[model samples]
Target: MEYDFTLKYQLAADDCDLDQIVERLAEAGCDDATIGVGQPGRVALVFAREGATALQALLSALEDVKQAVPSARLVEAAPDFVGLTDVADVAGVSRQNMRKLMLSHAAEFPIPVHEGNPSVWHLSDVLTWLNTRGGYDIKPDVLEIARSAKQVNLAKEARELEPRINQQLEYLLA
Candidate 1:
């Protein structure tokens, strides 16, 4: 079976250039790896395998890279999924608060579904909602109000600002 593996490494402050790391990995026989810049100073490498031996080779290459860059961290490697959930895990808020947020902010929250009801949200949908909603800071009402106000103000400001902005641009160009 084919499998995808993701390896993450955090670079030190001085080691910001990733070309060297990529070169090292390539030299170590990891030619088919895709490298990307992640949040802040982290780098991510994605590798694919066709069998257990290929996976082992990838792991060994990763280990070699890790030894060369001791600051790099091996975060995780798993199958990709659309969503995930842990019902009892509520670290960002108290259990009661989480329940309150769920109850009061139904519009902002992803709709939960009953097993028998197809109209209900899919597990993936609920998980997507939870992940997004969990990180959201504004209240539902506040968000609505802010959004409406922003629309109104933007329309008004655009009408007023466009002429002046255009004049400035014309002046700069001239």
Candidate 2:
């Protein structure tokens, strides 16, 4: 099954020209990918691919970007949902500590987008919260993995709904 993923990279240098990077990526086969400059001088790269694991997608994306923009460095790739374990890892804390921090700041912490055994929150939101609180340094590789996972999940969901959406359209046209 195909997966959708968004990988974020931090622009390594302040003077790095984004326009040049975008042109390079476009020429290197990531034409459909998105390159955005976000909070804390980050360049977020988002792409969707099918037929490989999330990690594979991440690697492929990185390879593509490297080919286009050798200096651009990915900084974050957190998926839409991440368990406490992953969150804690990103936050550089024990899972238990992460839980305690969440509990202590219940009102402020971004609520998980999805609730389950290990509730997950959007990578951007979580990192923003943590960065604001001066708790952790959001890492790029971690975000890349999260982005890949989230993309894959999104792709799967989209694929599942394709048939129904087509049927509805056909019915309306008929």
**TM-scores for candidates 1 onward, in order:** 0.40, 0.45
Each model's Cα RMSD: 18.1, 14.5
Please write out the lDDT profile of model 2 over residues 1-174, one tens digit for every residue: 344567666667653776776787789878657667655556776676543465786667768877877766555454666777777776788989878888999999888877776576876567668878884777655555555555655554556677889689669879
- lDDT over C-alpha atoms for residue 174 of model 1: 100
Candidate no. 1 TM-score:
0.40
Cα lDDT tens digits, model 1, 1-174, are 344555566678877777887787777655667778757788777765443443454456466667667677554332221111222131234546655665687677655543332233332333345557557343343223223323333344456667879789668879
The candidate scoring highest on lDDT is 2
Question: Local distance difference test, per candidate?
Answer: 0.51, 0.68
